[model samples]
Target: MRTQVCIIGGGPSGLLLSQLLDRAGIDTVVLERRSRDYVLSRIRAGVLESGTVGMLEKAGIATRAHAEGLPHTGTYLAVQNTGFRIDFDALIGKQVLVYGQTEVTRDLYDAREKADGIVVHELDGVELHDLDTDAPHVTYVKDGTTHRIDCDYVAGCDGFHGPSRQAIPKDVLTEYERVYPFGWLGVMADLPPVSHELIYANHPRGFALASMRSPTRSRYYIQAPVDDPLDKWTDDAFWDEFRRRLPHDSAEALITGPTIEKSIAPLRSYVADPMKWGRLFLVGDAAHIVPPTGAKGLNLAVSDVHYLFEALTSHYRDGDDHGIETYSQTALKRVWNAIRFSWWFTTTMHRFPGQEPFDQAIQDSELRNLQTSVNAQTVFSENYVGMPY
Candidate 1:
């Protein structure tokens, strides 16, 4: 097969890129390493930055999202079970939408199918060749047959574990990473959320967050050891521990239910310099990862897609290469800023293992400042709603 752009990943980023590019008169094909069912079943963050909502609109897939997504003007932050709201609308006149990542991916997939876009699934042994020169192609095995796609450009949206980022030469790629000592043990249930808006809590026991996928489906997380097995925390144990960490009001309002999904996700802040190498450009987790503290992972992926799509469109439609040549530099600027914000938020809200007294005091001071200082809340609101593209 031959195409203008071969997107190596059927996640939201890749699909969004393909959708946008196809509408702009560019032909593209998408490749995925997993079946469509598996991808849709994965649970992920639901917070949508204002910019993400706009991107969904640009892709012409926001009708369902806008109808079902919950808009929040503010969020509650807690320190030792007492909480205060950071009014995002008051601070910046912008708010975030609580829409699940799964829903976004579903929308993208639906759009792709309606538009008859190509997305290959359950491939094996994918490889990239001739990426340094103008003509690049990708190959993978499916159904006991070897398939090849020759394309003008490759968008590596296959994520951190995929072959995209590793295809970059070791000497050329620079990596920065901080793997946190703990992970978020999250549970998804069919019960109503404890609060209408999300609540992020910091307590002596651990950090906990009250979030939701929809009004009827709640998702919650509590900080726990990275290596702890799933069996370590039973349903009763999780609810009890979660209640102990939440504010008295939210805790009292919480409704416990059997979890439909539960897992431990290790936190990490990772970035790769120069998101582009030749015609193969890294997008989303293939290039960077931020802790879920600020719900920036999927949002960052959307931002990366925005940059790359603009660049590719400029190159194709108007015969301009400015955005194409500078895609990495431009995207990384925003990516780094998000990394800093996620790092700061994660540090402030979670109790590190073996943390000294001084560290706890410092975290407490920062939380207090955010609670009482208008300037601090403004900064939080700005970052939470996302910066401009």
Candidate 2:
């Protein structure tokens, strides 16, 4: 098979890139190692940055999202049993959309199918060949048969454990990572949310987040040990711990119910320098990962796709390679900024193990500064809404 671009993953990043390229009259094929059902089953962060929402509009897949997704103008920060709001719209005239990542993937999949875009799933042993050479190709086994795809370029959107990143030679790659001491124990329930907007609480025990998937469906999280087992947390126990971390009023208003889903996700910040390697490029989790405290992971992936899509379009349409030549540098600039923001936000909200009293004081001071200073709130709002792509 031959295509302009061979995408190694069929997740949102890969599918979004494929959809945009297809609309641009570029040929591309997406390969996935799992079934479509498995891919969509995974629950992920729902907060959408302005740039991500706009990109969905550009790809003609925002119809359902805009219709169903809630618009959040701001969020709350709770400290010392009290809460304060940071008005994103008031600060920067922008707001983020509360849309599940699953819904976004579903929309993209529907668009891709309607357009007759190529997506191969459940393939195994996917491999890349001659990535550094002018001619690049991918091979994989499907249904007990081997196949190869020849393309002008390859996009590595298969995520952190995918083969695309491993294809890059070690000598040319530098990786940086920071694993947080705690993980988030998240629960989804079929009940109204405690608040209309999200609330992030810094409690004496740990950190807790009050969020939602929809008006009637709620999502909540509390910081716990990284090695905590799922069986150790029952629905009742989870709710009790969650309520204790919030302000008295919020806790009083909080609705309790049986959880529909629950899981623990460890926090980490990781980045691989130089997202591009010859004809192979990294997108999304293949390139970097940010702690979820700032809700930057999926948004960062969207930004990476934006840079790469522009670069690929320029190369194919106008015979301009400048974007491609500087794809790494351009994307890395934004990637690093998000990484920094996620790290800072995580440090401020979560109580670390063996944390010194001085560190607690600093965290308190930071929150106080944000509460009193418009400049501090503006900076947080801008980063929360997203930096310009």
- Candidate 2's displacement at residue 82, Å, is 0.7
lDDT of 2: 0.95
Count of clashing residue pairs in every prediction: 0, 0
lDDT of each: 0.95, 0.95
Per residue, candidate 1 scores C-alpha lDDT tens digits across 140-198 of 99999999999999999999999999999999999999999999999999999999999
Q: What TM-score does prediction 2 earn? A: 0.99
Candidate 1 has what TM-score?
0.99
Local error of candidate 1 at residue 138 (angstroms): 0.9
**Which candidate number maximizes lDDT?**
2
Q: Where is model 2 more than 4 Å wrong at Cα?
A: none
